[model samples]
Target: MTYKEFMDSQTQLEAPAHLTPLLEALWYAGRDEWHRAHDIAQDNEHDPMHNWLHAFLHRQEGDFGNAAYWYRRANRTVYSGGLREEWQEMVRTQLPA
Candidate 1:
């Protein structure tokens, strides 16, 4: 899906079925469903991308220390951008052109 389509999906009651688990977490995050997003991210622990999403969720929750830990797990630097910008970056990176 395109980034715009992904963003627009936030208005719907459910995430698009084609989305990966990380994208589903992002979808929930866009809807301000932090716990749901966190749960999805946490459950998909086999990927660094999931760790990245977990870090983003923790950062959004104002849990900097936990965010740092997840960022380390993801092998990523702590994000310095605004949460929305970081979220958009994450979504855009995962979306098809």
Candidate 2:
């Protein structure tokens, strides 16, 4: 199903503790809703996970510089897991191409 549909299905249920808003934003990202994803993640000012999400959003928008900046903020070795494999593959492919 579409990501927004997936997210809509999950809305009322309690999200896992470390993944509340993150998962919500992830759904938006999967749907290619960059602004919606950004809105969901915006409150997490200093969170590494939020920074990572920002990186992913920027990457999807073809803003490598901002993506890199957020990646640095998150201090991650790679952006994987949580995200769908197809989306992750897109990001992986974009790394050098």
Instruction: Give me the displacement of residue 41 in model 1, in angstroms.
Output: 0.6
Candidate 1 per-residue lDDT, tens place, 1-97, comes to 8988888888999889978889999999988899999999999877999999999999999999999999999999999999999998889889875
Per-prediction backbone clash count: 0, 0
lDDT of 2 at 42: 76
- Candidate 2 residues lying further than 4 Å off, grouped into runs, are 1-19, 77-97
- Best candidate according to TM-score: 1
lDDT of each: 0.92, 0.64
Work out how many backbone clashes candidate 1 has.
0
State the lDDT of candidate 2 residue by residue for 1-97, as single tens digits.
3344444544544332444576667656766677978987677848887778887787777787887888898896455554466354433332332
Give TM per candidate. Answer: 0.94, 0.61
